[model samples]
Every structure is written in C-alpha cells, then in structure tokens.
Target: MNYTLHQLHIFVKITQTKSITKASEELHLTQPAVSIQLKNFQDQFEIPLTEVIGRQLYVTDFGREIAIAAEKILAEVHAINYKTQAYKGQLSGKLKLSVVSTGKYVIPYFLSDFLKKHQSIELILDVTNKTKVIESMEKNEVDFAFVSVLPEKLQVEGIELMPNKLYLIGSEKIDNNLNESPNSILEELPIIYREEGSGTRYTMEKFISLHQLNVKKKMELTSNEAVKQAVVAGLGYSIMPLIGIKNELLNGELVIIPVKGFPLSSIWNLIWLKNKGFSPVATAFLAHVKQEKTKIINEKFGWYLDYIAK
Candidate 1:
C-alpha cells in the first residue's frame, strides 16, 4: 500500500473530470501517460476507483471519497510550503475570494498589484454566479466575496469599490428609428436575460417589474458573456453592465439604447461575514484594496465613468 503523491494527483484529477482525456488535457500530460499512471494507482487498491459505462466515465463512490482526501492532502502540502515562506519573513498564506461572474472584469485589477507585492501569498479566485458566491460567503468557505448587489439577508461588512451601471444594449445593427421608450423597445425586441439566481437577473427583473414593462422573453443565458454574444448576434437586447461590454461598445459591435431611467446603477462591494475572522493574507488584501481602489478605478475604469456620464 505505497502510493506516490503524483498518483494521488492523477487520481484526483480523473475523479474531478470523470474522463481520462480531460484529465490528461488539464494536467498537460499525454493521454497514454495519464492512463498508465491511473492504472498504476488503481493497482495499489483492490476496490475500483473509476468505471466506464458506454463512452462515458464515472468516478465510483469510493473514488469521490478518495478525491476529497486527496484534496485535503494537497492543501496540507501547500500549507507546509507557505509555512517555510513565512519563516523567511514573507507574507505567505492563501487568500480566497468568490466573485460573481461579471466582477471578473473588476476584481482582477484590484488584485493584480496586491498579488505582485506579496509574491509568496497563494491566491484562489473563483469566478462564479452570485448565488454560489453568496453561498460560499455564508458557508465561510472564502475570505471575501465580490458582488454588485449586496445580500439583504447576510450580516456582512463591505467596502464599496466602484459604481456598476446597467444599460439596455443591442447590436449596433439595430435600427436607429426604433422607438426609444423603455416599454416600446422592450416590447419590440426579444429580451435576452441572465438565468435565475444571478445578480444581474435580479436587477433586470426588478427594473422590469417596476416599469411594468411587457418584455418579449427571447431566451435566458447563464453568463454575461453569453448574453453579450446573443445580443451581438442580433438575437435580442439585454440589460448588461457597462463594465463587461466596454470592448463591444468601443468596437461598435454593441450600442446602448436610450430609455427613460436607463443605466440602473449599483455599487460593487467586497464583502465578508461580520463574525468571520480573517487570515493575515486576507487582511493584507483588504488593506491593499482599501488603499488602491481609488487609484485602480481612476487608472483602469475611467472610461466607464465617462460613458455613464454621457
């Protein structure tokens, strides 16, 4: 019963992807190499770790448990390395953040300099939907959560980073003569929407309900990028954050339609639960954000402010 760390790593990846090919691709190893290692690892145990049914691969229940244990082992190894870095007088620990999908555009700029300054710190940034981000915060799984809309049910403290502006956008190919009235445009074009549990979806629904707009429901997509592509293809119009569509807007691939009470706005916030204790790495990241947010916004997102002003 001797197994190497490399075998454990391969097995963990196989369980995660449930496909030998995918595991190989993710690990940057050849398929034959992954298969050989997996076979070697499987031989060390009597019980089967994975099974193939038809063309699909599945991790057995035992494999799932082993993968979880493997994850814990890997994390411990990372911690040991971090400890050595700390003995060298470097700030070394994991800084984990769960950010809503659209925040990908904003959070990276905020993190870039901080991560550069603390080269020894390990950063784990998960870009996911708002529901998952909030759930991670509630479970105390991450050090911070970045969202445009603050959760009403969570007792959390947050710092406002910048304003997020949402506007109804369409392909630039849309006719200029179409009625600019909010209800008219909404009723005229099929409206692409983000899926339920998304922060953007919540805001869009609220706007629709408030205006009593009868929007033609064209389709629902799960991500901002998907919605953007749908709109760019002239599939429909969607209310999207200006931050995510800067490139499309600049390239004239998309256009903001003027409507009454347009550009619904919210503040982007980096939040954590009130009772949660922060690690040293998390504290340093928070401080870096507080000191650098203004500068980062002015330098990286000034165009967004100017666009909103017009």
Candidate 2:
C-alpha cells in the first residue's frame, strides 16, 4: 500500500544519473515505465524536486537534500545485500561500461579476456567517441568510460591507462614523390584530421603548432578506420595511434612518415563519476581492468600481420 522498494531503487538511480533514459538502462527498465514512476514520485512531492538546465537535469535544493538522505538509505540497504551475498560466495552481475572510439580498439580485448576470467559476469558495452563519452560521464550516463582528455569541472575520477605512441602515416599510394625527410613529408602531403573535440586531434594540433608547420588538411573523419582508410586511399596523410595502424604500416599500405618530430603520443585514462557509487559489477570490472592492463598490452598480436601486399 506504500511506496515499493523498487520505486525507491529506481528513483535513487534517477537522482544519481539525472536522466530518465540513463536510469532506465542501468535499472533495465523501459523509458515509459521509468517516466511513470518519476511522475508518480513527483506528484507525491509538494514542490518539483528537479529541474532541467541546458539539457542536463538537476536536483533542486530540496531534491538535493532529500537525495542525500536517499543515498544513505540506499547505501545501508545495499551493504546488507552485499554482506548476505558475500556469505553465499557468488559473483553474478552486469558491468555497464562505455568507451571512446580509440578505446573501441583496445578496451574490448581487455574486457573480453576479463569476462572469460570472471564467467559469472556480463559486460554491457557502448562504444562511442570521446565527446559523448565525457558528456555521458558528466551526466552519469555510463558507469565508466575510457578517455584521453579529462575536462575541468567534471565530477569524475580518472586513472591513467597505458600510453600508446602516436605516429604520422602517409599512404604509400599517395606520396609517389616520397622522401624520408620529415620536412619534405610536411611540405608535400595533405593532412587528414580527426573530428572536433577529439583528443587525437588536440594532440596533433598541439604538436603541429609546436613544430610550426603549415597544415594542408585534406580530409576529416570521426572514425579511426575512416582516417586510416583515407590515408590508405592516398587521399592524404594523418596522425594516429601506432598500435591501431600496425598492419597498414607493416604491409606498406601506409608509411610511417619520417617527419623529424611529426607524430606525438599521449596517455589514455579510465574515467568514472566521483559522486556515483559503483555497482558491485562495475567495481569488479574496474578491478579486472586494472589487473589485466599489462597482460592486454603484452599479448602479442601475432595475427597482426601486414595483411595488404604493399
């Protein structure tokens, strides 16, 4: 006859996530069902407990106060549940993770292997670009994300992932008048670029500016594959992770441009909200990633053959 525990659980998720859709995904409920519950909860209140500001929903002062109380309530309930489950000695849950595009290449292999080790868990993944990944993290859209850029004012925690070296690659198909000289490489080839807000793009621009080179951007793309494909098609030259283009480099579809200091590298990092409590599954998954990072990098990509015949 009173509010159900399910409602409180869903409502608490809503407060933490600040979006109906994110809460629905985390709680495995339909959007309409979440909306109905939200409306019911709001109707019970004397004043609206939240507001929308610039596409993000915020808990009002009163709502914030109540949500803090709700957090304590939920924490206690979960602690009890966790202790009971620990007594049973079972680990079964879903890990919800989102990642940036470049991470799409690296994170999955690491995650899959972790899943193999922890057979009782499931990995729910959403692979997106850096901008969306950061935005979603700020809004509590995902439990965790892998990123290269850590923005200011985002309430998040970041742990450094392994550093991947960057390289400037030119299509063997394009630079017919090729030279091993870095200056010549910069002087001759058109620069292909990644999309705006990309960490790779930022790094590339900084390096280019630092080196004081004239840029002739010929093409731009969002996907790493597109950038590589553009380079391979002889459309232009580009900079990217050396890890991602190993095959192309080995096969001679792409050539590592011999610019004195053309390519630059940076570290990637793991991200999660500072404010949100980790679900049991998410916690286990984070631990797994931390443990497996070295193995992931060291695992020789043997099939990593230069597939293209030059």
Global Cα RMSD, each model: 2.5, 6.9
Candidate 2, residue 38: the lDDT equals 75
Instruction: Candidate 1: list runs displaced more than 4 Å.
Output: 21-31, 53-69, 173-181
Distance from true position, residue 179, model 2, in Å? 13
Give the C-alpha miss distance for residue 51 in model 1, angstroms.
Answer: 3.6
TM, every model: 0.90, 0.64
RMSD of candidate 2 to the truth, in angstroms, is 6.9
The residue pairs found clashing in candidate 1 are none
The digit string of per-residue lDDT tens for model 1 on 1-310 reads 7888898899898988889999999899999999999999889889988899999998889888889999899889888999999999999998999999999999999999888989998888899889999999999999999999898899999999998999989996445444456776677888999988899998889989998988889999999999999999999889999999988988999999877777888889999999788999998999998898889999999898887787
Candidate 1 Cα lDDT to native: 0.90
Ten contiguous residues minimizing lDDT sum, candidate 1:
172-181
Query: lDDT of each prediction vs. the true structure?
Result: 0.90, 0.74
In candidate 1, position 207 carries an lDDT of 89
